[model samples]
Target: MQNDYMIVKEGGHSIALENGVFYNPKMKGLRDISVAFLKAAGAGGTTLLDSTSATGIRGIRYSDSGVAGLTFLDISEKASENTKRNVKRNNLEGISRVFNKSIQEFAHTREKFDIIDLDPFGSPMPYMNDIMKLSKGGTIMMVTATDTAVLCGAHPKACIKSYDSRPLHNELCKEVGIRILMGYAIRIAAKFNFGVDVLMVLSDMHYMRIFYRIRAGAENAVASMKEGGFGTYCNSCGSFGYSKGIAPVFQQACSNCGKRLEAFGPLYLGRLYDKRITGKILENLEDGNARKIIEVINDELDIPFFYNIPKITKLRRVGSASPAGIMSALGNAGHRCSPTQFSHSSIKTAAGIKAVEKALRSAKDFRLRAR
Candidate 1:
């Protein structure tokens, strides 16, 4: 109706997806989360750069949420035109500027932003260096990568080439993928002498998103690098462990089943979520789906990797066990545990595999007795 393409509504805003422009309807939840995060971080009166603004929905919503100044950038001219239209339709033209140029080009300008959102079509690896050039102290960077296959270890060689880290091709792949991303970004930022404070991370659907704040200083960069390490997995027993440092002496065999352990990393081994920032986002959040995801993320244990209950149950041949029941059993044993947002059938807990297996057996037995 507005242009050559159809008009669609998302996050309560109508956007025109012009022909040849890229816009994904499935990313609405992520856009909603972005708006909430901006509001929570007091992004009002600050400038924002939507580096891959397709239809400009994200930047427009951010403007509505009180972001004072906005710059929408896209490589396609059609995308830039569509964003311009959406800005006007939303009455945000007064505060928004649209540019048809690559982010690398824009980075050459003296303009810096308080927030930089990079939601590219695939890996954000190419733009990480330029992105750091547009950041100042305390700048918030929101990055999204949809190359799930590469990062999740379906293409191990590709991950190594792109992220400079190895990935696990198993039940723990999603979490490992996220850590690899964090590690990659931290390393890139460190090159610019900017350290990252991870605010939150999400591995939803087919993509992974991370929100982090950039802090300036060589000491801070070194501190962030200290969080980089390697992870060892026991494919035989579904057990995994991580050690902080570039080269950690890993146990040769699985501690649970005595099978050989495989190493995967040069990945991040730090807290994935900063509870304070997460709490702020929750306080400002209103979307149901975003709220549910954030609540789970808020409660997720700060452990490195999670266990897939289905995989564990099948491996141990202990019959089926419920995730809630397993959590209850672990809690009863004084071990802290919580469900991870990465997978419904998985959980993050400090309890070792033996303890987890014992809890699973007990829970299974209890279920059989009740039945």
Candidate 2:
């Protein structure tokens, strides 16, 4: 089992697909999950866009799933060409179409899709608005963000810059990372007059994946998101921390022992896993390989509760902004990198979440005092 190849058999058919071209456990598992969801949704005859169509694996997978209108896009000529060949090889010639252009350019104003998927190597932040706009009626958004720093609350400033929310850099707020990521994706949907309801979410190591049911809403969602606060988990020994839901989480020391705790602010504070959806999807995973992986997911879900930590590296930061661009430059550039050095002052508190007005007022006061 080297990185040299993968043999992906098409369903129960005798067809076999092989090459070093596309191979990843997570990608394969997630593709199957999406299929299960669409089947359960009982929604057919819809459009799907694979914005970052790496090797066209996702696009092909979706087509094979029986999703009606599938559009696969890639910035590279070679990549898109490969996608075309794969589609033809799989006999999905008419069902799927591959595009040679950046998703930024291909996601057009005139085009509306039923589902738009963004699985960039890192952050999917910048393209949120575009994804929302392209989704017509009630489009489903499936976002995969592997850059945990912004989601986990590692770089608070960076999180705010990309997601318009803060991360709670702690162990307990595993839900915080997913929520923050969801909140940001929702807000992006909102801007295009798309309201968001998180249909399902699976927050795993190194990445946070979300499936959203998006609709129209401009004012309501934005007003709700402007509120902010710190997300906190125990800094000393990684214990269960709290989300004050009040702005200004870092103004005080740890509640447990007065020790300074690491916190991310106002990251969407809530539960991460959904048992119902996870169960349904797993139930549909009847195939041997898919069932095997689905069992692992089921086990993780069955656990009472677990730690939530952000997984981001220096290199991943750049991936969010431009995944296709980065990949072309370095085919496989990502490797384990050192975690960000945590400082004592980096810990935050929950008050930063309770009231944004108070937090902003404090910021203004700080500016005034400096003057």
Candidate 3:
């Protein structure tokens, strides 16, 4: 309404998306989470770069959240103009700079930002190297990848080509995709002598986003690289496990079902969240959807991956069991368990597949007796 392209309001601000300028309303929840994360991470008085700014919504919201300085970049001249207009509309012009250039061009400058966000249309891989040039010690990088198919095994060749890792195309693929993305980031950052410490991760609809802090040191980079490894999964029995290291000898067959095992990775085998930061994010969050997702992620176990309850039950020919009931069964048996944000029907636990199968059997028995 204001700029002839129709004004839309989100996150307490009005933004107009010019033709050819990308703005997704569905990502508002993710944006809300980003705002909460920035506030929780002490964004006040820090410089932020919206590396792929389109409609300038992200940068505007960040500025409103107390970011001291802001730089918006977009390759499309129209997109750049749109961002500048939005910045002016939001009264952020004084503290904001809009550049009609690609991140690769912007990297030519020696300026480094305290926070950098890369939310491109598809994969962020094409821009990662230049992003590293803009990062320094204690830099917080927020990356979003919508090429879920490539990272989730729908296109194994593409995944291998892009991430240099294999992916699983199963119920666990989403988490695998996140790990693959993280592993790729770790490798790329290490090349520049930067270590990555995952602060938070989310596998939401059609995309996966990661927040990580950069530590500057060759030793830290080496330590971070040690977290990369392969994940071995059994298609026959659905049992999976991972080993820490770039290369570790894995059994050729499923230890439980004796079927040939398939491996995916060179993926990250480290904790996915910083519990302290997650708690702080929860405290600052106000959006209902964002809060709900963050709550599940905050409580999620730091386990490598999760098991889809429905998949396990179907494989075992048992009646479908509720995730809560399964968690209860595992807890009663003295195993730590939690529902995963990755999938509503999945649970993460240190208990082996055999224990989960046992819990499924008990749930089926209980249901029959009740009936």
Candidate 4:
């Protein structure tokens, strides 16, 4: 009866979402990425703990994909039973175990996991410390945050309260959300005397997923905190800059227009992606959409914020310009530019707002001359 209600196939595993168990068909791409990342990370024969497994689809897929040991933990009884059923359905019992216990409790147990994945319904902040306590040096911790509204600065109070970091909602909201999550992770891990080595940062649909490897040390944590930076955004000029440190020395005026600027940070100013790991993940991708997603992230410039071409154009009262044309102009001007996978109308470039506006104006003049 449970199997007859609702069933979905993902990563070659059949998962049943009957009896009111939670399962989102939309997360298949996420599962695909997880599988690829795990494979790329050489997760074979490694122990994995899905601390907040919903229907156990992710952990089941991992176990089936050759993770040597798999454990599924969910506070909900229905989810636990569903996990057990799904594990049995996939014949993954040999390499998998289901626990109807809280992740908090599991964190205090003697069990150790090489990979600890925390994918919750919203912010993962509440469980960050517990997960860190359970993780050993060299452990890989995967975290997902779905509170985009908060992380993107739509709810600034909540963002600051939950993440202990400021967020910006603009052309760079996605990147800001990604970094806020990372910066929060770095700060929390540091509390446990752990340093985080980011392996990947992914933005998809309505959530941000981050992968980090934890290293044990007080000095490393201190160094990481010092390396993080805050974003200074000027709403009036569409210009921004990054300053490294936990507390930003706010700039009162926009460097380009002399208009006042707003600061958003103590967020992650470090690189969002590790090129080598991303390349390996790309090689391991079997799904077309997943491959496309990684390709976009792979091509994104390792800069602070991306410019929304249309937004900037509207602000400057300029005619519409091609993303490719703008990028080419900026490239010709000796500034690195690339179209971001985050938004079709956005471009990641080292060029300042004034420089970009100049590029757009130049493009417009060239067009008028051609006509």
Candidate 5:
């Protein structure tokens, strides 16, 4: 049992991990980002709830960041005991509480949390309604979905069943996954006449995390619903376009190429991350990978899809061109271009596929001439 006391360092806090309780070292960047987000957003008057706390690392970290208070809730007695130990170990008895019961038990209770963090082992979809009920106006809810396949259209049926939205799998699959998750959250919150303002979203290494601020009222709910839309992608030409609203009509042929287009969505097509909050998060990040992720996110266009330069070059049978040179060429041609966080070699630009192909060919021709 002593071996279960393995100490783990995460963000600005340290905790002892239990044998059966989950504590992934790989998720350290996520924890650090959460901490930075809280600092930037100002966790005011918020009683934080780590709804799926296994080892209590997240709750303890939030408490250490001076959140008003936090409740560490877990269904496992082993995890509950470990949470108590970690709370005591960190000397945070005054502002921390441990509960060993299914989070659903709290649904009936009048008690509500200003911030409820759901980092479950799998899909958070099943618990969405109950958590929506537990949220009050102005509540901040954070959710993590590890079912990338379901959210990314690898399993279209499951994605539709779970999130009630169609997903796209391609170069922009990660962004589609994020949007699918966001669409689900918005719709779930709308059931309770609560609207969500997405604060931060991340798709890092096999999981997608989202933070939202809930606003109460039927009007806000309708406004949030309006953000839902669908994407039409042309497999033949790599051309894609999005139509706003739930009922979207897809053209029979691709606008750029005369090939049939495949449709994906009924998902959120709005902005993924708040620019101001992301800028602040970038300032607090110490890890290179996390900083780079945020930096790319900050630079990415609010558009739906990004084109992988390598894939584009391969499609054209031209020599590979640097992403930087392609972006520079596109920018010079009076088009907005930026690298996407989803793929390092990809660019999200207003330039059409034809324009991109031209840019790539021009860059290659210039390089050959110089040599």
Candidate 6:
């Protein structure tokens, strides 16, 4: 019966998913992500963890990938039980362990792992420190942030409160949303004394997501957000774009139409991918052991936007055709924004410009309220 859910292979190896289980379509792509990391680690087996093993699929696959051991954990009792069942069925009862416990309880203890994964439902905001607890040197943390729309600078204050960082929206590509989320998550991780390196960044079907391969220690990993700057975006009719390395000027109105422009703050540029790791993973993707999933690895490696830009956290884009217009608008407003991302649904010129003016007024309200 298990075979029905699995694709059995030549050596009697198989891949299967539990029936009536929690499955995000991103789950499949997630599998690809884990495999890529494992291949990059350059070991037969590594001590890998699925911090929130939703269906235990990631943990199970880790064990199957010639990993020496796997620790599958889930707050959900059913998920832990499901992991146990799958491990048993796959004959991984020996090296794979599943636990139903609070991540905080686990974090309070001393346990170091080669990889500590956190794929929580929405934000991993709750578990940043616990993740640090389990990690030592060179620890790779696979983090997934699925609450993309909110984190994509759609709402500056909301994204800030939720992620504890800023978000920069990119309008040129549909992927700007997820990139914004990843950028925010990275900045937050940095504030906690660990540097977040994006191992993989991807977007698909209403979901903007990323897999961060994080390690402890803030130095040598990335440039601190202290020195970083922001990007402003324009939201005008058909001429959407972004500007960088400058302040937003309020007086900057849309050249297309002599109307005021909405200015989102200096959003960060998310650029923390490890170039060596990214390349090494692609180079050593194959051996006699795996021929089945090579295509996925190759496809991911070829993404155009995959680059290692350092020290930036998040970048925001509203919809300006040129970055100058965006920066000009923000600068004129006499409003100071963090280097992190910020965007409101407001636009540039006329109706959109009115929204921008309104946003400035609100920021003032927030500042006054703080006092």
Worst 10 residues of 3 by lDDT: 362-371
Q: In model 4, which runs have C-alpha deviations exceeding 4 angstroms?
A: 2-4, 366-371
Clashes (backbone N, CA, C under 3 Å), per candidate, total 0, 32, 2, 0, 0, 30
For model 2, residues 1-371, the per-residue Cα lDDT tens digits are 25433445543322223453344555566677777766555447888888887667776766645688878887777667767776777788777878888877876745888888788878987777666657765777788888887677677788788877656655444457777776666556655665555567665556678886665666545543443345455454333444433354453565544567665544443433354665677667767655554454543422112321221111112111222222222223321111111211112222221122123233232221110
lDDT of 5 by residue, 280-370 (tens): 8877788678888888888778777788887766655567789999888888788899988778888898777878766776666633222
* Shift of residue 36 alpha carbon in model 2, Å: 1.8
Model 6 per-residue lDDT tens digits across residues 301-350: 22212111110111112222222333245446653221211112212232
Pick the winner on TM-score between candidates 2 and 4.
4
RMSD of each: 2.8, 14.1, 2.7, 2.8, 3.0, 12.1
Which stretches of candidate 6 lie above 4 Å from their native place? 1-20, 41-43, 153-157, 164-176, 215-218, 226-228, 237-371
lDDT comparing candidate 3 with the true structure: 0.90
Report the lDDT tens digits of candidate 3 across residue range 245-269: 8668778888888888999999998
lDDT per model vs. reference: 0.88, 0.56, 0.90, 0.83, 0.83, 0.52
For 1-371, candidate 1 gives per-residue lDDT tens digits of: 54478889887788888888887777788888888888877797999999999889888888756778999999988889889999998888888899999999988995889999999989999999998999998999999999999999999999999999999999888889999999999999999898899988998888899999999998899899999999999877789888897566778888777889999988999989888877888887775887899999888898788889999877765577789999999999998999998889988888788788778877777332210
Error of 3 at 362 (Å): 2.2
Q: Which candidate is the best by TM-score?
A: 3
Residue 89's lDDT in candidate 3: 92
- As a TM-score, model 4 comes out at 0.94
Taking the tens digit of each residue's C-alpha lDDT, what string does model 4 give over 6-100?
A: 77777777888867777777878888888888888889789999998878988988774468889999999988988888889999888888999
The worst-scoring run of ten residues by lDDT in candidate 1 lies at: 362-371
Off by over 4 Å in 5: 366-371
